[model samples]
Target: EYLHFNLFKENKDTFEANTIITRLLGLRTGASSVTFAGTKDKRGVTVQRACLRCVDHERLATVNQRLQGIRLGTFAYAKEPLRLGQLKGNRFTIIVRQIQPTAAAATLAGDALRAALQKRVIDEFAEKGFVNYFGMQRFGTRDIGTHQAGILMLAGQWQETINLIMAPKSGESATITAARAQWAEHHDAKAALAMGFSSLYGSAERALLQWYARHPELRHDPHAALFSALPRNLRTMYLHAYQSWIWNQIVSIRLDRYGPTARKGDLVLVDPAVDDVDDELVSAVDAASAAPKEDADAVPRVAVRALTAEEAAQTSMFDVVVPKPGWNVTYPDFLLPHYQSLMAQHQLDPLDMRRKWHECSLPGDYRHVLGRPRDVTVAFQRYTDPQRPLVPTDLDQITEAPTKFRAAPAPFQALPDVGPYDALILGFTLGTSQYATVALREIVEAD
Candidate 1:
């Protein structure tokens, strides 16, 4: 049996936190033994369900005592393991502080006017939804982004791909950056592994370097072998990020040409029972690729069709669909030309996306061009100390901590105190693959 626990973390990414827990439990298999519904942001406190297979409960009790930034609670045994995108949806309580308007929006700067504008935005988003563009976080902060590595992988530039993955970036410590620079200059796997990089962010590089050190024979041409040595999920992330980039470009074009309104050749989901579109319901079927072979039957099969000009008139923004760029997906007739042009810029052919590497071969999937947030609520508050938290986290409520409602020092609190700053607390539920950051972008009108 597996043990399920509610994981609460502040200022830690889901992957990094899971790695620490894995090591603490002495799980030699590492990340393969742990599972979570979805990844959460590292900047804020987030509560989510996670599971570890065949774990000793006694060891889990020590985690709370040992870990500083993480908390584990409400443990239970379950028959099944938690998989990515397995949850119905995520409930978020996000706090946006130091509210200020842009030059364009500065004319209406009073509290009442700002409140009215926010209300209008929330109401419009609730009804028609905002553009479901991939957030900036999907691509890494480096000049050579994750999607660029994906492009290189697909194009069979293995050396270039590995170089991109191991390249050093800004904001890293001198030692870590030096290690990466050493690898770049010498390509000496044994030398790089000897230096050691046990940091949370250095796991991928360490794994790849270790593989090369063990198999010195493959060091001369270690692209395919090196790529294969890494975990499946990590490889999949690169391809997914590339697909997301293409989807973002295509969706932006579609929205610019046809806002909210469905076009003649736009694609929409069709259920056998309901001949027309099901605009009100968001299905949990977009995560087909994320599911394992054992869970194939659990994924629901969704059918889609191109809308006729007459049928298009009856549909709403939720009815429009965009292809995630793969060999298996069908692009909307109206957007096919745009997809071809965009793919050509990267020397890729969207018509035939098959690659020799299984990780690079994307089968494609469909996602709604727009996503609506459910059970949404917005409230404004005035706070004296910016270091204090405006919303209570799940751990606070679970532990019944007296400080739940009181002002406490928090991590990563950098909001300057321009006295009497307004804090916007938003409570909403969003389905899997939907970005809360993107939703916030719509509310704040941020670039």
Candidate 2:
């Protein structure tokens, strides 16, 4: 049986949210039984659907009551589990705050000028879609070393991966910073093992340390042992992050080659159910590889095929799809040079990506070259600082008012005077695997 819940999470990642719910339900099957369409941002308030197996109403209620920073809005039983990329799209209501007029227009009139600028930006986005670049969140915020570690892992450099994972970053906690410093200074298995036992070290780091402590003789071939010690999800993530980085580079190159449009040799993705034998084989292989590890009963598949001259004529109606490099994945002839150059730059061969560990192997996937937001609407409003009095100009009069006036202030206080700052409220919807943050970047031009 499948159970669905409306998850409202604030400042929490999807993994942490799932972990909380799994613990609250007291399900022996653990987190693997729960599934979600996609992950939401950790720093924002997001509402999305999630599913679990063999959960009842009572347990769900207990979960809602026990969990903090997450509230269940709706609950129902489903005949099937919610698989990844199952959603049609997500609706976003984002408030862009601290907006200021451009320097050229700063001297112009008050709110009107800011509002016009905001509208112009929104209109530009509506006319031309934003660059579909992967946001920085895909990499670690503090370290930004996941892709580097992934590169090392793929190259069979185990010690380097360990170093990258345990290295000290600028804003780490005191304990972590000190532990990493000790590891960096000594570079000894025994010392690192001792440090990893500390409460500050995460499970993956501790696992590596424990492996080193257990098998000191295998120091020369530590890559295999050290990598095997990490959790399966983490190992998979390392490879996935590397693939994402490669895809990002390729997308940048594609934009340079074909400016905002597709050509005859370009590739486009369509529904996998197309009556093509090659597409079916790709779907089957991806499903077989991913289903067991991800506990996904059903996997969604799409076909990535090169556009013919006839198809390219209507390219604007479809999205250009690029392959996430893998051992078995095929690429169009036109893009082969670019792919080869990128792989050469990283000193990697496609054959080397094949791994004995199935979880770490790439199952081959496709991502669109351009992401366009749908049903976009924007509104502008004057922002006011709530801290000071509603009218800073009238502060002296309020302070000097009579004792009776001070004793009982007016119930309906005047609205705060509008400040120079303006806020932009943007509403839009994006399909699965698309990021709202990426779309917002086109307007704000911030990282």
Candidate 3:
């Protein structure tokens, strides 16, 4: 029989064991393992509780030092694992310990989560001497501006963690000394169930538990009770659907250029909210990864279709459309003649349009607004001074006049009568959903 046990500071007295089990399990960091080694069942208590202990203050302290360096959430892991009585508490000490994983492996939940757990462990032991189990946030910033350097540090903390993984040596003391961040995230996730902070794990636990179910051996465990109240299948569908929502929102904001589209359990570290604080991090990653976010180079070269002799002065809405390079300027069937006029006024030569020419970027791509509705999209359209951005369209067309009707002034051109190219097509929903996609991108990437 397998017993998942968590150990903690037991007041030096064995009987008062369950006192803080709730707190221990609430942490969102670190890995824990429990084995029945052998249970000494006594008659004093009844509600099943777990028996576990902290590994060592030094190991924990080392982790804490690493945590202070990066600055996300890391205070939880310093405590011990919390044990729940598989059998209602009858006082008994279950031999349990924190072990390390063998290899660098990926856990679908994501790496930011693992770093979170490590941060907790480090904090718990910081009272004593230590070394970082989570590695360092040190990265080169020779070209980044001074202000951007600080922003890069803040934002790239997670991205830089891509290097912090502790590869357990044969002589290492822990089970998984420093497994891949993903593995720690999963292990910590299971450990966190013992903690009271279960709500923080809403979607993650469901996905992991489902993955655990694939192994018939663990499937029968009572842990299934955690999700029994929800639909039998809702657990499986949560992640994918959530990710789809995220991708849709990001697409709507035009921030799908970053690591967009999430599957049920895919690992994504780009959060738009953080971008505001560390805007340069995204730029740094993008600059290094080439123009991956825009994949501007990937568009296939399509042969331009020449207008037919009779179609030269075409009458159809689509007829007026001349596919411009790099612009999403297709004339949808829904476009009206009034829109053409709007488009002409909106149009500018190549140098005048910074975005289409790949001239600028939002602080971050919007990932948070996924599945959620957005009312508007904003961006720095003129790019240069006046420096004012423009609102291409109301995503929902919900804004009232004067209240939300204020749009940035654009330098008007002598445009021919035409339809609006920069308009919203709500009959169909886009992933980002708005023409001024920068805000949509912002929305999509929000925490």
User: Which candidate's TM-score is highest?
Assistant: 1
For candidate 2, write residues 1-447 as lDDT tens digits: 988877777767776677567766776544456688767767767778888887785567655546677766457898999976466677777767666656756765566766676666667676576666666667656655578877887776777787787776788666666667776786565675555444322245665666666777775676666655665556766776788788888878877876667777777655644422211123333364566754432445445677898888787733666777775556777777887888887797654556665555565566666667788887655547635333222222222323321333354355433666656768887765567788777777667
Candidate 1 shows a clash count of 0
Candidate 3 Cα deviation (angstroms), residue 46? 48
Which sections of candidate 1 miss by over 4 Å? 101-118, 193-196, 272-302, 398-419
Give lDDT tens digits, candidate 3, residues 219-303. Answer: 3343342243222222222211222222332233322332232222222232333222211112221231234546644433222
The lDDT of model 2 is 0.65
Q: Cα lDDT for residue 436, model 3?
A: 19
For every model in order, what is the number of clashing pairs? 0, 0, 64
List the candidate numbers ranked by lDDT, top first.
1, 2, 3
Model 2, clash count?
Answer: 0
TM-score of each: 0.86, 0.74, 0.17
TM-score quality measure for candidate 1: 0.86
Q: What is the C-alpha RMSD of each candidate to the true structure, in Å?
A: 4.9, 9.0, 28.3
Candidate 2 vs candidate 3, lDDT winner: 2
